[model samples]
Target: MYVAVKGGERAIEASYRLLDAARRGDPAVPELQVGQLQQQMRLLVDRVMAEASLHDPELAALALKQAQGDAIEAVFLLRAYRSTLPRFGYGEPLDTARMRASRRICAVFKDVPGGQVLGATHDYTQRLLDFGLLCPDAGHAVIQAASGAPVPDAMPSALAALAAEGLIEPQRPSAGDPEPPDITRVPPSYPLPRTARLQMLARGDEGWVLGMAYSTQRGYANTHPFAGEVRVGHVPVEIVPDELGFPIEIGEVELTECQMINQFTGSADVAPQFTRGYGLAFGRSERKTMAVSLVDRVMRADEFGEDRTSPSQDQEFVLPHSDNVEASGFVQHLKLPHYVTFESELQLIRALREAWDARTTVPPRSVEPSTKEVCAK
Candidate 1:
């Protein structure tokens, strides 16, 4: 279960040097700045931040640079860096309803409260590569330009309307406003509460989440999810000081949230109402947001009396395996020396083979004719 890796100090140091050179490819070319990575590779930074559960964009960009653009490796670097930092007090739950939305869309309703603002999305753009991006001035490369319009002060959730009609399931908090368990602070056990589960999903690997969510679409869990609403915006992060005894806005972080509406059972099967799932992540991650939302709905199969027919539906299966850091460490550990364990296996196999040969090759003791039979012959 553990790697008993042994190596020479010289060899390890040499390997480290080689890795440094590999990370800094082609020194003759202009080195990439942290600012350039922050602007150009914004999505990469976002993914690292989400996976690492760290909010700093600059560090995320630096981690990506250090890891040579490997998202999982960048996440590992970021998480390692995060472990050293001191913990401040927790922030108040962001009121996403009052968020300054840059993009908002809802598949359930065509005419939402604020209308569908496409924002800076490539959804409508042509798939062809624009070679104009290679030029010094890449500003004009896009098919459409930003209108430079101000977003509304707040965009009400599309779910609000559905809730008013009593067609949607309620997600009201319980009494006493209990503090949610932080996975970083507490070791998780299965059958986690919604809050802890949501926190884990927020930091889960994007690729794995997408695969799990896609399984539901392909008739595995079959939630029949619609994009109830997907909002991308920046929300203020507030901290309540012990002395002050009131929350104050420290800063803001960009977040992408998805509220997926699923129609699992019809009127014949159950009451004709829609179930809702929530997903929130750091920065403008649409696919991750949608996937997390879909998976979240499937995870609630027990509450809604839906059958647990897929891996995604099982929280035990999903949450424990979704962390890329843990998964990557485990898989990569195979590269380490397992010579002692492997040698034992080899010896066992050889002994078994030798025993088989001895059993098969030994001539059956010649049936010695009984004395009477020999005499008769």
Candidate 2:
């Protein structure tokens, strides 16, 4: 109790010093540059950016370095910084149909319009680790091989072909198409719209989303899906300036987009057609995007007349718990002092124990012999 309460300002200042020393490690070693993190640990940077909902690679790398590579901590730092930045205006939805795709594939189709382009995946490689990578040149050579590969001129979606044949269900905007609510600006209530749910899941922890998606695959949810198309590329962002009446290309952002074709036997009102689940993320995170897409389908159970019995199908269970930052803060709060609350419980337990001991220790009350027994004696 003394350490927990009385240490106060001096203790915190000392702890900060200790942390700084720990982060620096051996002074003999050269400190890691931010560019090294951005280039070498780019995947981590991408994850942090997506979770934080910020698109700055350099800032994400800096956050990762500051947190000593603790991903959730990096996300927390980045998100906090993002809150301080001024917002200019919202960008319009990206036209992904015209994306300059670098990596494109379709599991459902034997041959897509432009054929499968395996740009930079480790998917086909043997799972065994190559000890050759212990040499610096070997690692560089491996990455260099993946660079400058030929890409398709016109990589088209396989789902578009299906939709043309009326085998796919089309999505139309809601009546009046009201603007989607921003969860960061306003807290979300239950029965969230599709747009809001998508926003929440995209900003969710990657691991949690993956687990939820895996649950659906393991028969937790009745979702029969195929990888309709998975594409990675850069798409131009357009924004209409307040002064200008029309849109203008701002800049290009790297993205990974996934479309999952789900089996949907139509309800009474409609004919049977393939439904779609979509996932799009800030950078080339195929694993994260695929998981998000699968879960997206599971989360739409109610709308598609499917059972809401699975954990993946419960919006309340998924949306609120998906954020690692919020979850980490809450779970880590247990380390903080709860002296008053614990003391109250301790007194209660002490009183209860005393009552129990008194009840058990008391000699059985010797009642006067029953009148009938006395008479008999």
Candidate 3:
């Protein structure tokens, strides 16, 4: 019997060798440097960092090279590497109010405190490609520094204005000295709190988050939301040392923050007030932050006493499937050997068919046996 099976260990080794050769196509062409990918392909590096939940650009760049520019695979690599690192103490919660912003925009207000510094955005760019970019020089944008007085160091949050007017829900100070939940330490469970949900979405696949957000806009758990503010900037990271009682600034990290205001439903004690959804992520991840904010609002349907009939609103569905790594691993496992189980199924089907045929078909009467038995008698 000729039993078919996939290639052995030697074949697997050859496949890996082939993959490496293919990754470095054309020996005449210089191999892409990690620095080039980090600097020139910054957006991709940023996406990888965000998805991997690791903020190291250098690591992300290296992962990108290893993964051959597959963003999801790069993220997986970075995440795998991150799991091997030693743990340091957690940093205090970030305060975006004190952020030194590189980009800030408010859709609710025409003009904001910082005057909407539109830094390196493609919002107004045309969809048509400029073939000129094929030339290296064409890729560079003109650099001109503004010769003017410095802008304010801080800007008032657009949400603050609405909250002051009693139009939006009031922001409450944290009660008790509570540490922020770390999903990396403990696995998430049912009825996830807002913090865990935000953490999951921040590190979730961009496409999955975007799709869920889009579903809400398309009337699945519809809640009309306005982009109250979107800001990308650097903020100081503070950590309180166990040896020292007070906190100290460890470093600064670039972050994108989104605040969304949604339609109001009147509560028993309070009049109708616009609800708020918040999202914050490492790097200039505007799209991810925006999607996170929208989805965050939908996930809060239960807390708001709204109907939880939609897929996005169901925490059970969204939280588990949001993780790209787990989902991809399970899905990709289909390629693994299933011949034993399949063979069992094949036998069952054959047996069922045989029984059906036996039940339906009338067996030819044992005429020969009857004639023989009559002769014997």
Can you give the lDDT of residue 269 in candidate 2? Answer: 81
| lDDT by residue for model 1 (1-377), tens | 44345556667789889999998789997788889999989988999999999999999999999888999999999999999999876888899887899999988898988888888888889999988778876775453554667779798887888889978877788346678999998999888878888889889999899999999999999668899999999999889999999999989999999999987554455677888888999998899989988888888887767689998888888997999999999999888878889999999999999999988896757787899998998
Quantify how close model 1 is to the true structure by its C-alpha RMSD in Å: 4.0
lDDT ranking from best candidate downward = 2, 1, 3
Cα RMSD to the true fold for all candidates: 4.0, 3.9, 5.5
Candidate 1 Cα outliers beyond 4 Å, as residue runs: 1-7, 140-145, 174-177, 264-271, 362-377
**Candidate 3 wrongly placed segments (more than 4 Å):** 1-7, 144-151, 173-178, 359-377
State the C-alpha lDDT per candidate: 0.88, 0.88, 0.85
lDDT of 3 by residue, 19-110 (tens): 99989999998899999998888888999999899999999999999999988889889999999999877788788898988888899888
Question: Which scores greater on lDDT, model 1 or model 3?
Answer: 1
lDDT of 3: 0.85
Candidate 1 vs candidate 3: the TM-score winner is 1
Which candidate number would show the highest TM-score if scored against the true structure? 2
Model 3 Cα shift for residue 58 (angstroms): 1.0
- Count of backbone clashes for each model? 0, 0, 0
Q: Which ten residues in a row have the lowest lDDT in candidate 3?
A: 139-148
What 10-residue stretch in candidate 1 is worst by lDDT?
1-10
- TM-score per prediction, in order, is 0.90, 0.92, 0.90
